[model samples]
Target: MRRAIAGLLGAGLVVGALAGCAPAASDRPLVVVTTNILGDVVGELVGDQVEVMTLMRPDADPHSFEISAQEEARLRTADLLVSNGLGLEEGLQQHVDAAAAEGVPTVEAGDLITPLAYADGDAEGLDDPHLWTDPTRMVDVVAGLTDSLETALGDELDAGELAASSAAYTAELRALDAEMASAFAAIPEAQRALVTNHHVFGYLAARYDVAVIGAVVPSGTTLAAPSASDLDDLVSAIDRTGVRAIFADSSQPDRLAQVLADEAGVDVAVVDLFTESLSEPGEGAETYLQMMRTNTERIATGLSP
Candidate 1:
């Protein structure tokens, strides 16, 4: 009888372990996102049907963030990998490429949008990777993400349900685009100038009729520093144009912006916007939509009288 009891106890332990290892019935597809912005977009698209994990933390620089060994393991097992693809994730390119080589489905959201070339003489000849600056572009990304989700989730996702949800989200982004255009239209054409730390907002300014007066770094990528001549040229341009505020990326250091602001002697408010990645959950700029809205409101407030 003691031997029989021991066998029964062993069986019970095995059952408990198996039960613990089983995923919940409602657990959705696993999605690993390379950046917070893409994470937010995927979260909205997949909703309750997918488990989304963002690699980059809030306010982390996309060009500099490195993935850990544990993160690589997660990537290997994730159902999908979504990234803000216009070369923004420069540091993680190798890992993403490896995932693609291993047959993991990887979606590059920037490919859906018509990329805007960086203005001549900006950082490293790199294309502006901050595509979400334009809300319309975000609508396109949402559609691409929806397609990727449907492909990954297969019959697990209801086709009609996903389509309807994507349509609703796209409509919201369209409205945001209109609202920003109208608000920025109110800024005087002459004063509609931007002096940012880097050339991250070339598309933004171009879309809204604002002039990119000068950038402290004067490069498309934020990984480079400005030479003495670059700083001198920016200072001269700022003095000549009478540009007001100098916008800075939330993830970049503010020392350069501060120096420019001090030298320019203008009301250079150090506006920190989510240019590279979204903020953490509960922050104002946590989601892609919120990030754009927050940036629009800030830019309008700064540039407007």
Candidate 2:
């Protein structure tokens, strides 16, 4: 009986010691990412170095996707909060702000890159928040994000490994950029005009020298409804520009674009693009790289004039 009691006491002490050595809630560093694009980028960069808690899911609209109160609490507890600033996350701004108010280090990926403004429509001069449309800009975002992660994570992150991972990812972005450039080069200059559902492709048009003739909604965000005048103007522009294909965001209803296409009386092919969100597995775009590649291929095929 004495020997059994001694062994039990020893095991209890060992368990206590193990419990004492475990990391606390605050000590266990976490990264909360807002948009899935940035979430995926951060995941690729951090890679098990720290926990990445992504708030938004695949195929969800960033402009209008809201988080629950629990997610807001998680945001506040993060060691670092990474978001695509420039007001891209319009719906989740308050939650992100709540986290920042609690002293969480925030990295606005949009602010890190060279921000571009809307080239046309009512949103002109407003900073275009769709920087990820251009992979070169995403490369810049990736570099800035790496620095931000290192600064926020400090010694918790392995610098050498992070650098290597970042370099590899940046290389992939560059490669994708080159491939896109080569593909867009095939588009005859006359067929390089874009007329999408909204003003989401400014960076892409700017990057590839494609003309932004018009958008059905006449604004940057999908929430904006198109006025009759706006639709009329777009129809005129589509007819005038000889726009063979009109790209609609898959996440949004194609009803507006269809209306424009039918009213314009043009043989415009309304192609669907995963502009603001990623799709589920077995779908065309599941990752950031895959999304970009798929968009490029679809754009090429749709507007091959």
Candidate 3:
């Protein structure tokens, strides 16, 4: 009986040890991305290597989005955090700082791209934060995201997997850039002018040889409202330039665009484009490539006779 009791105790110890030392199931690292655009880019690079949670929903404005308590919890627990980082997430900085203070790895994709300075005096000495407007710049962002993911997953991820994915995605973006250039080429040079709600497409316009006559918002940021003089000047410019379309961000209210169009006395169509955010799933502009394509096509149609 004494021998049997000793054997039973030994068996219990063995079971407990085995339970503690059994091969743990491989769980992917959790990565939290602040903007939907960065989230999509990171998702493309990481693939299934990491679990990605996007804080901003589709078509949500990055400058004004508020994080919930649950989102803060997720951020706190996240192994990595990705963001645009050039004053893009205007309202979410405190939360990001909190996450950073906790020693979570964070990446700013925009830092990899060559930033353009704001042309207008309003954004004095500030570089334009909308690097995603250029496909070449997006390649830089993908590289940064790949590096961040590799750091997180290390040997668990297949060697060169991130590189392979980045190459494929970069090729697609290059093709997209070519396609956009061709589409924009179709518009008459005289009419190849854009009037957006804000100076969001300066890089894009420069790349495709389109002139940005004026913006409804006087500044690069959407938070700034256009003054009466600003509106009057824009109206005068539209009349002089004969611009056919006034494009607006789909995420923002179009009351200003409508008012400008009504006052301009020209055929000013309010073309909605995915400027700072992607559309929801199943929408035409869900992906970055899709968003660019949709916006270019709409711009072409609206500008053409």
For model 2, the stretches where C-alpha displacement exceeds 4 angstroms are 1-28
Clashes of 3: 0
After TM-score superposition, the amount by which residue 239's alpha carbon in candidate 2 deviates from its true location, in angstroms, is 1.0
Write the residue-wise lDDT of candidate 2 on 1-305 in tens digits: 99999999999999999999988665457999998888889999989888999888888999999888888888898889999988888999988887788799999988788799887778889999999999999999989989998999899999999999999999999999999999999999899888898999999988898888988888888888888889888888888888888999988889988888899998999999999988888798889999999999999988895
Q: Write the per-residue lDDT of candidate 3 for residues 1-305, one digit (tens) a residue.
A: 99999999999999999999999854878899999888888788778987889999998988889989999998988888998987889889899999999988888876888788777737756878888888878877887778877886677676487889889999998998889889989998998998999888877887889888889996878888898999999999999999888999999999999999999998788989899999998777898888888888899999998
True-structure lDDT of candidate 2: 0.90
lDDT for model 1, on a 0 to 1 scale?
0.83
What is the TM-score of each predicted model, taking all chains together?
0.90, 0.91, 0.89
**True-vs-predicted CA distance for residue 201, candidate 3, Å:** 0.4
Clashes of 1: 2
Question: In terms of TM-score, how similar is model 2 to the real structure?
Answer: 0.91
Candidate 3: which stretches are off by over 4 Å?
A: 1-26
Superposed by TM-score, candidate 3 places the C-alpha of residue 261 at a distance from the truth, in angstroms, of 0.6
Highest TM-score model number: 2
Residue 136, model 2: Cα distance from true site in angstroms: 0.7
